[model samples]
Target chain A: MLELQDISVIFHPGTIHEKVALSHINFRIEEGDFITIIGSNGAGKSTLFQTISGAIAPYQGHIFLHQQDITSLKEHKRSRFIGRLFQDPLKGTAPSMTIAENLALAGCQGHYFSLKPILAKQRQQMYEALKELNLGLEERMDTKVGVLSGGQRQALSLLMATYAKPQLLLLDEHTAALDPQTASKVLELTDKIVKKNQMTTLMITHNMQDALTYGQKIMIMKEGQIIDVINSERKKDLTVEQLIHLYSSKTNDYNDRILL
Target chain B: MLNQVVVIGALELGSIFAIMSLGLYISYKVLNLPDLTVDGSFTLGCAVSAVMTLSGHPVIGLILAFISGLLAGVVTGVLTTKLKIASLLAGILTMTGLYSVNLKIMNDSPHISLFDCSTVFTPLSVFGEYGVLLFIGVVVIVVTLCLHYFLKTQFGLALRACGDNEDMVKASSIDVDIMKMIGLSLANGLVSLSGAIYAQHQAFSDSQSGTGMMVIGLASIIIGMAFIKKDQMAYQLLAVIVGSIIYRGILTIALQIGIPSTDLKLLSAILVVVALILTKVKMRRKEVC
Candidate 1:
């Protein structure tokens, strides 16, 4: 469903502050694949996600989505096929909108905007989706999102990210900010929805345990290098300490030059 | 006699100021940006609409006013979103540039008058004595209602999102740049619309009409919000409308108590700053308590 070939991204390439964030990176994922990426700080985790989502152009390489080259597409254009969740809870959803209003925006994707109100049918559909989250947020169809709790907002954001039913979901630590229990619950909801929808997903996580436990594959990034790629087969047998060992050894030489 | 004019002056001036406040609501309330372009675009609207009205085509005058205001707004959006200029500086620059643009657009005429001219409201004025005030009132109510309807639509939701959370909207696959452009256009439309109405009603559009308009709008919005606390559509809509009326009322009462016309701008500025501070302090106190 997604492919990145020999992608090289350098920031300020020739300037005094020039640094390589991603260097000749190659990666691939099959359709219906859910890949969890784990990386320490400054390992270009976010940058990698950005590159895949076309937030930033990869300095060198072709990005393919389902087969078409999408490297040159702008973030908004690529967004139709991709859904993203940021680490910051406040960043993932409009805080001042009703849940339904936010969902309506996502629902209206790829359609020409007219002077009409959100259709009654679309609102009913949104209500059903909100109800399924089990957050008791469906009643909040008219509530301003700014008044929602952080966890609720993040969940709503997750729901919005999926509202348009994108081909790929990129979760950039979506649950990283929630209380542990809320985080766990959100992840559970994520699992259920992603499986039901069979969405091709790539989620970056700082939580090593989460990386190992969720998703069909686990990939460790170290200094812009994919130190190890483990499929469900390998992921099942892996442990956190062992994965850390692999990451340190493979990326030791580039640790000093680590760039996010 | 002077006191009577102050009563009339307060309502008339307040009504005009309401126009700016309504525009501010779009940018600040809906879009959540401290857009400063209004100061310039209000004048831009007045300039175009006033000139066109004086030339005997007030409908075209208003349309041109809105279009020109939209252009000024786009320039501000580009400066901030595309050029990465700071919000405050972008507004200041736009306002400065508009001085020259207004001059050129008006054939370097310092002012334009519609004393003998026909405006969008000319036909409505067959009622005679109440013509000017009635025209302004109808314009405000109609435009506000249209905006109320517009803000309830899907596109409006996205525009609101663009204000509160750009990332989420982007994640949802909505383009923030396009939203910003459209938002600014709509916001400035309200401001320029006010300017257009003000031009015809006053029978003159001076380059100075738009000066300090931002402050006046803020004052009205702050006052309006003070009266309406619910986040529901009706409340928000009511807040802008009532806030405008009350703001004008306060100015009227103050003028009745003997404040000079020359100090109205100063009074408006003080009104805005004080209202802003009061709201901030109230919110803070609520959080603390």
Candidate 2:
């Protein structure tokens, strides 16, 4: 449902310190496509996500969603259809606010000038949704999000990002900072939510096994280009060893985090 | 050691100042903006109220004062958000420019005496000596309730989140710039309303009356919040009002001890500095525990 044509992002252009973050990138995200991106540092994966989400305007090219140009839409306006989660759990939720309030904010998305208070129906919906996370958060909806563990916060972030049911969801290393157990737990939650809602999602990760395990397609990036995209058929029989071999064969470089 | 009359007078003035503190509570506490526009907007309220009261429309004067205050906040908001001016500098620029605007509003006069004019309090004389106090007390309560309700609304939730975390607010599909502008406008509007009430209470409006006003409001907020440990909004607002009264009470004691009125501004600055140091020390101690 989303397409990027010849997108490029150059930082400090024309200066001696100029560096190209993305170059002549082209990609199409089909409806309900769960795309997992694997890239080394400076591979332009995050930059590509930022460009599509409107955080940074691409130096060149056009972005179309559902065949309509939204290249010039402001970041906040574009957020109506694009839900984003960052690596930092703290970045997604307000620490000082309660869990229910955070959920309320996410549910009220796209109503820019609304003065309506949280309705009883919304509170009930939030309670039901939190219960589904199985985090025992429903009973403590009044508790501030700050005191929650990193895993809980990320799970909550996932729910909030998908609560309003955006047209596209962007997950940028959302579980990388958590403990391995918590990371896997959050990943499972992510999988369940995306499947239940059928959300079109793009998740960035350095973990090779995760890259091979989840999502319908694995997009491999090097330098500033999408070098390969393994479809669902190819992904079914792909192993970590084979994926690593496929990556190093293209770039002749091996990174430790990606292997992990 | 103070008598009932002096205590009542302090409360009347305290109630007036509480209105301004409520404004400061939004800008400084909720929105996390240091809005120096408080100084300029407060005086703008007095100037507008004075001109309006002189024209036999004390009620309209109050309404206009609040509107003027909102406009002052808008200017500061525009400078900080659109023009990329720092919040402190934006407030300073607005306050400095408002000096001239305040003068023009007062018809080039530095002060206006409302001694013989009718005020909102004049019609309540039949309630005897405590008429003004009773009226101001009810107004403060009404304002506190309205403000509390507003803060609980979904829009207020977004505003608070904007202050708490701007990125999250943006990710939630809310515009942070527009929220900040609306917040500052509301904050300064309440401050101007306070100033209008102050002019009516004191029977005069002076251009220099707003001097050190921002410090005074900060001191009241800091002192009040120090006593209120709960994160609940209602208790926090009550602390502001009580802190204002306590600040006024301390000033009364200072006067009774024969401290010169000229030294009061110095005292206000010192009080704010002391309160800040205390709160910092308290926070550090908590972290240690």
TM-score of each: 0.92, 0.99
lDDT of 1 by residue, B71-169 (tens): 888888888888889877887898899988988877798887678777776787587746667767777777778878888787777777787777666
Clashes found in each candidate (C-alpha, N, C closer than 3 A) = 2, 0
lDDT of 2 by residue, B16-79 (tens): 9999999999999889999998999999999999899999999999999999999999999999
How far residue B53's Cα lies from its native spot in candidate 2, in Å, is: 0.9
Identify the runs in model 2 with alpha carbons over 4 angstroms from their true place.
none
Cα deviation in Å at residue B247, candidate 1?
2.1
* Number of the predicted model whose TM-score against the real structure is largest: 2
- CA lDDT for candidate 2: 0.91
Off by over 4 Å in 1: A239-260, B1-9, B116-128
Q: What is the TM-score of chain B in candidate 2?
A: 0.98
Tell me what fraction of the real C-alpha contacts between chains A and B each candidate also makes: 0.71, 0.79
lDDT of 1 at B180: 83
